[model samples]
Target: MHSYSRLHHQSGHAAILFSLFIPVLFGIFTLGTDGARAIQDKARLLEAVEVASLAVAGQGSDNVDLAKQYLEYYFPAATIQDSDIQIKKINCEDNDRCQDNESRFFEYQVTAKISQPTWFPGNEAIIGFGDAYDVASRSVTRKYHSETVDVILVADFSASMYNRWNGGSKRKFLDLKDIIVVIADELDSFNGYMADKSLKNKLGIVGFDYYTSRYNNNTRYFYSHLICGSNEKECTKTNPGGSTNSVNYSATVRDIFNLNSIAHTPWQKREVTNISSFEDVLLTDDMASLKTKINSNSFNITSGSGSGTAFYAGLIRGAQMIYQQGENPRQLIIVLSDGEESNKNTTQKLIQAGLCKTIFDKLNSQQQSNGDNVKARIFAVGFDYNVNNNPQLADCVGAENVFQAQNRDDIKNKILELITEEIGHLAQ
Candidate 1:
């Protein structure tokens, strides 16, 4: 009986020990799982805050309330009470305290915190103590207005331009609008002066197409009648609005849309009148209006691929415009098209036959000239069914200048990359 009682006592002690250890093991397991979840939540919140802050800074929103609203949209579950965001704009000169350039770079810092309640006895008790939980994440972006670019858009509105490029869902007309809106918005970034007094660049546009019915002056380039009003008078009695001589845009892109229009005259009377300057208008707005017009007019791609695709003709005209300015400014030609140049001789058999190749080769040689100091880089975007097959059109703007996109997103990204790279080059 004494031995049996001693054995029973040992067994009871062992059972008690196991019971104590069971809770400790279970507590540890639960803590690990819950801790992982808390960490994930914290990381997600930090990312959300960072993105929100960037959006606020990019939009140039001064109202704190709007920022808060934007934050909620990005992080639907995260409360502003749990996060702190601070924004600072430092001059490029003051960036490293070197005071080298006056460009402004905005820095945004976001700090977020959240607490999770513990349920286990030890952890639950510690919740009342100072040991809740904490995690951190960080991201940085630099913003500056360091350079200005005056762009001359040369769009291709030729007969062969009928294409369904955006995944067989969008026609050329629709896609062009999408491209314009994006480029214009990017161009608007040029404030010329940043918060830190850095210089932001400006953009200009020149869209071209066939509308070449009248050309009396036969001037290589003619100022838009839209700018100064009636061609008959220097300045019209009507408020001629803004001049379309230099249309401003924010982003870098190709010019396929030509705003050149023939004077509205009857076909019979056309011979009687001697035309001076056939106005090739593009845009007239300085800021938001330009952006709005691009968005509005993009979808309105006119029918009838008139005259023909004057690929190099447009380039020559654009280059001349830059020359007429008399200032040695940085010039870039963005050619967005299918790259098929029409044989003008087919339409006018008696006209000069070899002009296209002659003109094209001259421009090509000039672009490749080693002594040319003017920064003129051309970016040719092609939507060819087979990129390798279409060498002439794609190669017009130079090999380095060519960019082929598969979709709208790809096109947008490539354009942004090109513009950013050019800006970096200018900074140097």
Candidate 2:
């Protein structure tokens, strides 16, 4: 009878122990489930913050709303209070101090709250833990800007550029000119970093054909216009014909001594001079005047009998202008052409002369450097030209940088897209 009573007492103790331990086990399981959910919410919040920061950084100061939208999409179960979100411009020049008002980067901070109910009864009260958890994340994004910029516009003025497309009303030259004008307008309106008065962007123009001008059978010239002046009026120079007067005087005393009354000798002069090699016509910050010069100079008909495209000559001339700029400036060359090289022999001669190969080699070398900054970039546009079959012209720049257009509207749209992309480039 005593043994039975002892067994009953031990059974009661075992029941009590099981009752006490069951609640502890349930509490541990509920805590683990809630903790996992909280950790997942925090990780998701971090991802959203990073993505939002990158989007805002890529788009500049105008994309704050976009960041909020991204957060809402990524953390649909959590409440993202606007009051808990902070957006601030930060200067990460050295050690991410962020004290300076001049912002070079943007900082995004997000605080998310997620509600998770306890699975075990009285677990939250016993643990003194809240039903909801808060997670905060921060991210910093930087902007990209070059210290200086030098742009060279190389335009092809071959005879074919003046020809109209198959069914288009506008000539290929007009399309090319319109694209150039758009570029000029964008440059003039730019107000970003390195676009200030102390670091104004420089632009140069080159127009290339087989023969720019020929006064006689022995004379052949390459015409270029450099606009480096502050305004249009200062960019003009005396024409070639006005520079000298070649008058043959007879071996008579009357002709040699008659200086006062020379029968009003007329000076055959032009307002511009075309040199044997492409010369700088203007190298200036005056984008307005540069656009005017491009319109006036690039739209002319082929001037000489040998109607061929000197693509290398034009590219070399533009490179020459870019090379003259300050060291490590962001250099870009935009080449527009309607056809490939028409004179292979002349092209080979130029390449041997170091004019064709030198420019491309320099560009390639700059692009291949190990530094973060790309010292040079080349963009080429082909008007009604087969870029796939004839890749040599685009290869001078880079195959990926080439663009082909069929008509005027297509050219304009493509150029606009290029400009927008260039302007919106993210800084490293």
Candidate 3:
């Protein structure tokens, strides 16, 4: 009987041990799952703060109210209470202190804290069971501001331009016109807005054909006989215009830098050309003359001997124009081309000159040493050009800025998208 009692006692003791361990195991599993979930939520909250703060930093005063709107759009769960989130230029003064010297860098400082009840009964001990525990996160992001942009559009107005053989030939011409109008409209849209209130970003247009020329009140060769006024409506009108005895010029072949010598396309090679000569290609009242010439077939591609694609020249001139606009502004060149450079110079050289390594290096050196902040982004488009053969050209613009369109239908949409993106960046 005693032996039986001993066995029973041992069994009871084992049962008690097992019972105690069951709860401990349960607690471990519960803690593991809930802890992981809490960690995930914490990470998400931190991300929300980061995204919201970055959005605020990039925005203008008019857009500050909309910053939170973007944050909610990005993170619906993280509710922003009044003054709970703040963004400002990174400076010593942000912590309520100011420096005698100027602040060099700007960052988006985000502060957020969250509180929620514990899920498990025992978790109160780990997460302040009796009261809610606060989970807070802080993050800072640098500001990307486009102080100024020197913009130039190198358009193709070659003889092949008149080729009616292609589908939507007339539409192609209109597309170019629309592109010009769109760019002008975009610039005008940004007209009094600037990152620095004191800075005024300048805008210029350079049209290219066999040649390249800056568009002024006298630019011609495509549509409307009158050089387009600063306003979009004036640009669209077909009349002789504001009628102040103004002279208009058409963009033509010689204005562009021709790579081929007489043996190939007939333009002198290695000859240093002046901007004034590039300027002279514009004919007073050139648009009217261009329309007449286009109708008459006088401006035909076969009419010209030069086949040298002066793309590099256009890029160089465009960069020059940007540089001339004061080193303080950003420099951007939009190069539009349809076909590969036929008998012209090597395409690689042109792509690299202003779009690739050289420009970036130049800007980086200036920015580091002098805070010139003169970086420029190129938007290279190969319209109807064979993608495989010409891939390198657009690639030189950097993956982000390069663009391609299978045909004319995609041109306007793509251009508009790029312009819109840039505007957003500028506003930020």
Candidate 4:
């Protein structure tokens, strides 16, 4: 009977020990489950915040609603309050400090907070910890703006540019003129942000044709008509009396170094001072004058002889002018052509002579020295010309930069699209 009593006492001790350790085991299980849930919630919240930040960066100032929408879409089950999401515009002058302000180039910040419930019993009352924990994440994105850009518009005024298209309703030369006017208007629209002295935009024009005039030299051409001097009857016998015409004279390549031969009015000249107000650089009068000059009798070719597209000359001149701007500014050369080069050997020779290689080398050296800044880029637009067939053209610029337009309207749209993509502010 005594031994039975001792066994009962030992059994009571075992029961007490089991009861004491049960709560510890339960707490461990709760921690494992709740810990995993917290980790998963944190990861989900981070991803949602990143996506929301990107969305908000793309949109304008009214980005809070969009951010909240993205958060809800990414985290469907989480009860996210509108107050828990915050969006702010951050303006960073340099890489260091960012503040909330208005600037041409800025950044957007998106922050999200979600309260996740703990699935453990001891989380609420036994410990001083709360029943729910907060999981929050923030993301920042930068926006891009136009850099200081210098563009050289190298246009082809070859004989082929006079060809008629669109059922003879539009000429290729006329379409090219229209495209240039459109591009000028687009550039003028950026006066507000470009008012900064360091961020100005400059453009130069280069019109190329055959071997009529040498580089950096002025050549005069004269067109004559029968002149009646003192004897109208005699002149009429020799020529026509009723038909009165006069001789005309004009100079080609008037100023090659400065490219004044094309068109460089006072308004078209590069601005020296910081623009205090918006000015229409390419005004209606300017466009009319340009059209008149391009369509003048001087530009008309009377002889088919000595007619060829000297594309290499144009490219070299354009590169020289663009490089004169400075090493720091972003340089771009835009070639507008309606036909392929007449002399491929000459073009290849020019390329081998370091026409494009010099610019590429300088750009490479600059990139290596200064952490990947803007380099010289070339874009080509062909009208009624197959850019893909011209491998040399693609090699001169880049294959991806070549564009071909089917019609006049398409040319304008494509050029506008290309320029907008090159210079427009975007989310980075």
Query: Against the unseen true structure, what C-alpha lDDT does each candidate score?
Result: 0.45, 0.54, 0.46, 0.55
Query: What is the C-alpha lDDT profile of model 1 across 130-168, one tens digit per residue?
Result: 234444445444544444455555555554454566543
Best by TM-score: 2
lDDT of 1: 0.45
- Tens-digit lDDT track for model 4 on 129-173? 257777899887765555645566777766666667662256666
Cα error of candidate 2 at position 142, Å: 8.9
Arrange candidates by lDDT, descending: 4, 2, 3, 1
Better of 1 and 4 by lDDT: 4
lDDT of 2 by residue, 281-368 (tens): 4456788887776667435654433345657546655665666542334667777787567645434433344443455556545532
What would the per-residue lDDT of candidate 3 be over residues 163-258, giving only the tens digit for each residue? Answer: 442434553434554465555554443433333455443445454443443324543222211222232122212112223323122211122222
For candidate 4, list the clashing residue pairs, or say none.
Answer: none
Q: What's the number of clashes in each of the models?
A: 22, 17, 14, 0
Those runs of model 3 whose alpha carbons end farther than 4 Å from true positions after fitting are 6-24, 48-146, 157-191, 195-198, 213-310, 323-327, 344-379, 383-387, 391-428
Question: If scored against the real structure, what TM-score would every candidate get?
Answer: 0.46, 0.49, 0.44, 0.47
User: Which portions of model 2 show Cα errors greater than 4 Å?
Assistant: 1-147, 166-169, 191-196, 212-281, 302-306, 325-328, 348-357, 361-374, 407-428
The candidate that wins on lDDT is 4
TM-score of 2: 0.49
